[model samples]
Target: MSNDEDWYQRYLDMQNEYDYENTTDASYVQSKPVQLCSKESLNNFGATIIPVFYYVNFLLSYLGNGLVLFIIYKYEELKSVTNIFLLNLVLSNILFASSLPFWATYHMSEWIFGLALCKIVSSAYFIGFYSSILFLTLMTFDRYLAVVHAVAAAKSRKRAYAIIASMVVWCISIIASIKELVLKNVSENQFSGLMCDESGYPDSTMARWRLVTYYQQFLLFFLLPLFMVMYCYISITIRILSTRMKEKCRAIKLIFVIIFTFFACWTPYNIVILLRAIQISNPGEGVSMCSEEESLDYALYMTRNIAYLYCCISPVFYTFVGKKFQSHFRRLMAKNIPCLKRHVSLNSQSTRTTSQKTPHSTYEY
Candidate 1:
């Protein structure tokens, strides 16, 4: 029995030694280093936590943006130049939010849909993202003209001209997005898994073009517009404070709140991306260009998640704040107090009759 036990122990020791030798072989040691940002790992992250959060965010943003669009479209009162710009903004955001599901799905797994979807999905993202920024910038400019140069703006804001300008903005957005559609391609990574991304630009020319495009995006979309928004709001704020016209003050306050809300939702993402662009020389990394590009990627990913939260909830803010809500509350009051409606109707009729009777005759003759 003792001899048998010693023989078994020696056999176990021999097996362990052989296993260690095989593991340390040169061939085994030369095996490929595992990629940290591989499809499998990214998918794991995307599938488990990231997708669910973004999906909920996307749903909220879609509903809010869609509601805003419907309000602008359904009500003639909400179809003014101000509301028209907002309609376009909401439309762009809706389109942008719609792409989140595809992205979330992609993050969960490899590009299973195919090549065509990759192009269409990615192009929609670019179109919506670019157009959103452009429209917001246009809105700010429109506000600037309306408030700072009211006479000029009024003269130029003819219905036909406004329609044409809106068309032109759409046209430009389409043109700008064409490159993105063409540049993106689907290819397999080192691990034999497929990925739908901008790939196969081996030359410096394509690399440079991508880099330039990213910088352009940052400058045109974020930096320039952000500066303009800041300037317009600051000037407008000063004007409101200086004049202290209590009647117009509420409207000015609404605009300020809207601008602040925009900044609160987007500034972190923009700043993080800008830092990333500064760090990376490549166009693909985007906001991942910071010194700690990998860490930045993770941070941008997290920040984007946070941005979506803010953006998705922004509509709720819009619904509750400022003149929109105040008017709604007043309507509720009118509903509860039917007598107030009768008085308002009577006053409106009286004013209309007086205007019809007097008009140009009382003013000129």
Candidate 2:
């Protein structure tokens, strides 16, 4: 056998024969030594990239979502069924961003916060992350019903219904995150030191659990919801074009913006993890090249930074693109940035009409 194949074979043999109970060092059989990121590389990569991204995301997400919450609280018009969903979306972002400081510190230093805090923070992060996606899905459905089946939607629409839906989404997300809440703890990484990493060894059972969760995340968070969003948006587009619902044009634009932003921020990260999942699922083998493994490690690090940046991006999108949001935000800014209020006119930006506009009309949502 060639040297490469022989080396790979031996690595696999070692992995299969490894006894975690006896071993002091938790070494997995990987073909590429570089795949196990070195301490200097990790410090340079993790400390610099992750903390910068996390802190930026945290600050912007907090400010943006906080502003949305304030707008909802201060304005009478922001209480519509659709806006209620938007309110919940902002809340999800805030909740998600709140977990960032812990993670930022975790990535930069050791897991000094102990096991219980690790579990709580991880649970909060998962709940916030998943719930944002769920609420977005709900918003799409609300739009679909409002535009495609206006009268029927109106008959069914209640402020109470939106509240109930928001509660259900949050409840489901929290329940789904319970496993992570239980599993997460402060553990020692050979390279990264005592950190809030997964405590499990890379054994068969953990591998299976990882596979299941990976599939669950891909389907629930990415594939299925993406398909649903596409269908809803497309149907809404067709109806709007046929009826020339010009006011609904902004709503359609918002949908496109949201879908594009979501995929842009999340697709590469999800794809990288999915590849890792496939590797994990069928891992009696080793990678062929050190550079290949290094590339993948870099890819994961970069893509995760991109995904985390989404929490920051979301609030900006709502603030800039959602005309109603812009109007209210300007009003808030005007109070402080006093000279800027001269040109502000919310009446023109208002989506409400004598008939309350289409249910899915801009900000009518």
Candidate 3:
């Protein structure tokens, strides 16, 4: 019995030695000088969080912007220049929200939709984004003209001019988004199955294209519009402070909200985009590169989600903040909901009396 136990122990030792040798040989054969960064955790986090927020944003933007559109159509005829701009802005929000479901599904899973939809959806998304910024900038300019250069702008701020301006903005947005339609397609990702993204170009060409796209968005869509909005609002503020406008307080409050919301939501995303462009231009080596990329990925994800929320809040800034819109909305609710009719009527009467007292107020809309 002792001899048999000794033989079994010898066999176990020999087997362990063989296994260790094989593992060492395998490791030597497969060893890499530099380890690749894994983004599995980031992808998982995005798949879990992004879809939910996107769906919520879609719902809120659709509801708010849709209600604004309905109120505008029902109560306020598109006669005034402001009303025309407002209509285009609401349309832009709806257009932007319309693409959210596709993106949400894309984030949740892979891009099951085909190549054609990939192109169309991508183009629509960018066009909507650019158009929204343009419309908001145009609105600010319109307000500035109405408030700062009232007499000078009266002749030019016609409905015809507004329509023409909206058309021109749409053309610019579409032109800006042409690359999405041209370059985006359904491609296979090794880790994530298929995705809808830019493809079909040489590596160098694709890299250049991406850099151009980032700068285009950062400069044309974000920075330019931001500067324009800031200039207009600052001018408006100065004019209001210098004058004795009855609605100066409300104007100031609206301007603050607009600037604050725009800056808070978009600045981070633009900064992340600019950083990504710089990183791509000059990529670092090894573990540090991996870490920097991971950080940027996380930042882009978070800041993009924040930026998307702007559409959801746009209706509040553009329409709900206006007393005229409030009166119209209340009247609209009163028309639909019989229970609130009496209360709304009384409120409308009070609003009308106040408006009559201040008949020449240009800031009502």
Candidate 4:
């Protein structure tokens, strides 16, 4: 029995030694490093988190943006040069938010929708994103010209000019998004399922493409737009302070809030992508030591979700904050929604009846 136990222990030792030798062989050692940012992390973080965010933003944006669209469409009085910009802004947000479900599904499972939709959905997202910034910038500029050169703007800022500007903005947005239509497709890896991502090109080309697009979005969408908005608003603020236009307080406050919200959501997202672009440039080993790249992955993940939320809140800035829009919204809400109308009518009736029942109540009941 003792001799058998010693022999079994020696056999186990020999097996462990042989296994270690095989593991350290040239072929095994030379194998490419595993991509940490791929399936496992996405399955854990993205699939669990992104769909909820996508759906929440989708519902909020659809209702808010859709309400703005409805108000503009139903009421002729709601239409104006600034309101036209708001209309386009709401439209683009709705168009963008409509694609959220697909992205959510893409992250969770296969891109079962296919290649054509991948292109359309992907391109539409960018078109919506760029158009959003464009309209917001134009809105700021319109306000700037209106406040600074009121009489001149009144003469120049016609409905025709707004329509032409809307067309131009849409055209530019579409032009910028054409690359997504060409590049975005269903991913081929079985493990990743059918992902609708930019996987049609080689690694080198994809890296270059990502870098170019990152810089483009950073410069055009974020930085330049940020500078322009801040400049216009700061100039407007100075002008207002120098003059006696106290009624401009509400508008300026809303503008400040809008700019702050935009930056809060997008600045981190852009910074994360810029870090990713920088990491991509470093190739392999040297870049991996930045706290295991998980922090970068998580940041990119979280910031993207934050960015999508802006569409949901934009209508709050554009419509709900405006007195005209509120009155119109209230009227429209009272008119179309029977339950709301009934509630309001009942409340009014009860108030009138109570007034009539009171001693000093000769007021119309």
Candidate 5:
């Protein structure tokens, strides 16, 4: 009996030794350091490229939109609802363009403007972005009314109505951007020094805030407005096609251009924003993959730059395309610029002659 007891004790000791060895090996594997993903190359690329593009955009947007404002103020009586909407659109573009320089500086260096300026700049930027989209939607609706429901539009599209609509759009834009005003501040980054971004919260809280804002922009600014603009343009196209108006083909072409431009400018940015929102929501799969996150960062930057070009292009599409505006601009320049007087007079005479030949043709809007 004593010999059997001793053998059993030895077997139990061997089992314990095996279990301890397995535990020690498992902990050793778990304790190894994780390799962190570095974004230094991406940051350097952005610092090199973003400032240049932003400065160019700022210059072009201000010049184009400012010229539109000057032409409209000098010539238009502000009675046309379309002109009123165009004024608001140009103003929105200017407001948006005003923030580009600050952002350019931010990209080149740290946010040296402090927390107050950061909030103001961020809020203004978002307000201008939101207002510009809203105004475009309103303008499309105005066109839809003019083409699809001409008689009713003639009755309802008054200067008062346009003023009220402008006010409402501005209010909505401010409200939508209130988040930026509330949340934006200068946060310290170890690699980048100070950054003007959302902070003062836990990582989880910041992620949630970002997710909410991204979806808000995606849904309200991009998706909803896109649907509205598409519907308006489609209705306008169908109405123009069914009619026998002499300018129907020209009108259809303009509608196609507007829709195409809108999609080309905004779709990629919004799609990337939606992806970012999804990645934020699904941390286990999306956040764990550093390669995917870095790719998304690159995508977001490129797409946003594409979207920024619209501020410069909007003036050409909305204002300069109109013959009336061109005439006004020529006359304004001729009056102010001595060298162009002779050319302007000749062009004016030629335009008048062309107008006389086509009495039924209206100014392109």
Candidate 6:
């Protein structure tokens, strides 16, 4: 056999023989190398680093998503048309972020949790991630409708529709992710640590499914939303420049920023995944499959981390952008505040006295 075929054969054999075992469990296999052939290049680095990355991501994502939920819940005024989108975004992020711990543990040890959790939790990860993307896409469309087609949007921006759409998005996400249950089975690698990926090593079907998912996300979540957002922003910019409504202009700018942030963080991951799909389809034609997998895996992880930043930074946008949410927030704050209430009462009393002291002018007739 040629050297290339030999290398590929060795890689294939490595895949079949690799054992991932729980060090604590005596039953765990410890016959093969601790790492996969795919990750051979990173063999110099300790496996412990992976867990550390996961833990840090878990902490940041949990705190950020929690705070976003709090901000929306605490301030009633944030429940405007704009914030409806934000609320969905936060909910999706929170659920998605919760999966980090499970992944972190899975990386460190065997799938001791069992098949049910292995299937369900991993599926939940996809659901959360996909749902977030859908919600962001919805938000972009919502913004476009309000800014570009205001009159039509005013009539159609019903809370009922938003609720219905969110429900649909989630339902679809759950259904799409459910397939993971059937696809993933428990397996022990060379290290004897149980892992939960596709049963067959380097399964092309699994790669195709992953590629399809990425493509769907790109078309539905990124491209469509990007087009609409760009159109809306361009139109909004022209309108703002021609008009004198400073507050409205600022609101449009803020919405643009939010859209830009999503696009910036997620675009790299999407492009990389698509390219990965291409490389997978035409393998051994100069593309290093092992290196591609490692790079794509790292890129996916980093992209997810960057995307979570939006969850943390978005509260600031809500506070600063969208005059309506801010107005509502201020009114809610004013009402809840004792000092502001007292001050307002005193101001009202002074106003009454001044009115009583003043004489009516002939113009009153």
What's the TM-score of each model vs. the native? 0.70, 0.80, 0.88, 0.80, 0.86, 0.70
Worst 10 residues of 2 by lDDT: 30-39
Q: What is the descending lDDT order?
A: 3, 5, 4, 2, 1, 6
- Give per-residue lDDT, candidate 1, residue 304: 71
lDDT of 5: 0.85
The sequence of per-residue lDDT tens digits that candidate 5 reaches over residues 141-202 is 98888778887887998999999999999999999889887778798989999999987778
Residue-wise C-alpha lDDT for candidate 6, range 1-365, written one tens digit per residue: 99999999999887666643344445564543343345643432224655666667567766655655665677655445656767777777777767767876776666788878888778878787778767766775776576557778879888877878888889977886877777878888896478877676466678777777767767776677667666766666665555545244454566567667767876776677677667667754223556666777667666656665554344444444443344444555567796676665565565456445534210010
For model 4, residues 108-205, the per-residue Cα lDDT tens digits are 77789989999999998899888987888888788778876777897999999899999999999999898998888777786876778887689999
For residues 1-365, write the lDDT of model 3, one tens digit per residue.
59999999999999999888887895756765666899898989889998998898899888888898888878889899988988898888788888999998998899998999999989888888889889989988998899889999998989899999999999999999999988898889888999898888888988999999999989998999999999998898888778766767877888887889899999999999999999999988889999999999999988987887896668657888877988988988898999999999999899888778764577664
How well is each residue in 1-365 modelled by candidate 2, as lDDT tens digits? Answer: 99999999999888867765335443544434443423476467878788888888898888777777777788645457977888888888888889999988977877888888888888889898888888878888887888788889888878989999999999989988888775676777776688775556556766677787778788888788788888988887787767645466666676677779877888898898788787676543234543445566788888877877785556556546755666667787778886776655444344334225554343332
- What clash pairs does model 2 have? 82-365, 83-365
Clashes by residue pair, model 1: 273-287, 276-287, 276-289, 276-290, 279-289, 280-289
Q: In model 1, where do residues sit more than 4 Å from their true spots?
A: 1-43, 77-79, 190-192, 203-206, 247-256, 282-291, 306-365
**C-alpha lDDT of residue 290 in model 2:** 39
Question: Model 3: runs farther than 4 Å from truth?
Answer: 1-35
Identify the leading candidate in terms of TM-score: 3
Candidate 5, residue 5: the lDDT equals 98
Query: How accurate locally, in lDDT, is each candidate?
Result: 0.67, 0.75, 0.88, 0.78, 0.85, 0.64
What residue pairs are clashing in model 5? none
Model 2: residue 139 alpha-carbon error in angstroms? 0.8
Off by over 4 Å in 6: 1-38, 41-50, 77-80, 200-202, 247-256, 285-289, 311-365
Q: Which residue pairs clash in candidate 3?
A: none
The model with the greater lDDT, 1 or 5, is 5
